[model samples]
Target: MQITASTVSLTVDDVAASQRFFTTHLGYVEQAAAEGFASLARSDAALDVVLLARGTEVLPADQRDRHASGLILAFTATGIEAEEERLRAEGVEITMPLREEPWGERLFQVTDPNGVIVQFVEWVTPSAPANA
Candidate 1:
């Protein structure tokens, strides 16, 4: 199957908060919106983001009441340090300070108003293992 686009649908308690965070900080534009739903798009990628109000009828019966939890929406980014600084200057709290792992992944995180965790990551060349 050929996929032309992708989207992550999140059930949230406050659609407006998620909508504001995406559009204001993440460079997403609204494709569509209604009382309890929003479709967001970005020019740089095919990944779209959809926000649905928790308990809204638009979701399946079994999923309607569930809010997004234990999920970290991550974006692979360049110049992560600069991005982190820019976000900090914009008053966005850094839930996880920028740090690097032994495997060569640099990342940081921020939590949106509704408690959704968004992370930015950058990969660097890993050092050769001692036993390699």
Candidate 2:
């Protein structure tokens, strides 16, 4: 099957809080919203986001009360250093400081008002071995 797009649905205690955080800080615009639900999107290829209030009936009974946790919604981006600095300058708390891994992945994270972890990542060329 050909997939046209992607979206991440997160269940939070306060949908409005997460909605404001995403739209205000993450460059997402509201596609639609209701009393306890909101759909957010960006012009870029970034995945769409849907925030749902906990215990919303749209979800099945078994999963209705489960809040989003234990997942880091990571987005691959460019110029992450500058992005991090810009976020800092805008008063966004840096939950995870920017750091580079030996395998060439550089990443940092910020926690939303509802405690969702959003990470931005970039990749660089790995260093050659000294013996090379």
Candidate 3:
């Protein structure tokens, strides 16, 4: 059996800004956009997002956290430090420092302007030294 992750849903407060961030920084292409929603695609992967304008919903502001916690979405990176530096150069906030974990993965965290946390990780794989 085989499984492939294709899409996920994210709630953002701004449509155009989020779209720009995703397309410009994350390399996602816009597949669709509407009054308050957009679907962006990244190569074979895609994200289904709904931009909820202020005062359009009836729920209290605090309740939004109910489903927003503990979701770790990781994007594999070639050089975690290099990626971190590039993002920092672009004026994006880096919430966590890059560090190698006990599991041997170099990982870091960044919170998007809309409050979504993105984790960047690169697996530790041994290979012949560059001099070889």
- In terms of lDDT, which candidate is strongest? 2
Across residues 39-109, which tens digit of lDDT does each residue of candidate 2 receive?
A: 99999999999999999999999989999999999999999999999999989999999999878999999
lDDT of 1 by residue, 1-132 (tens): 998898999999999999999899889999999999999999996469999999998678999999899999999989999999999999999999999998999999999888899999999998788899
Task: For each candidate, give its TM-score against the true structure.
Answer: 0.94, 0.96, 0.71
Q: Go through the candidates in order and give the clash count of each.
A: 0, 0, 0
Of the candidates shown, which would achieve the greatest TM-score relative to the real structure? Answer: 2
Off by over 4 Å in 2: 129-132
How accurate locally, in lDDT, is each candidate?
A: 0.93, 0.95, 0.68
lDDT-sorted candidate list, best first:
2, 1, 3
The positional error of residue 33 in candidate 1, measured at the CA in angstroms, is 0.4
Residues 1-132 of candidate 3 have per-residue lDDT tens digits of 676555655555665776677777777788877765667777644344444333334436764433433566578767779888988899888889898875668899877666667788888954556588
Candidate 2 vs candidate 3: the TM-score winner is: 2
TM-score of 3: 0.71
lDDT of 3 at 65: 30
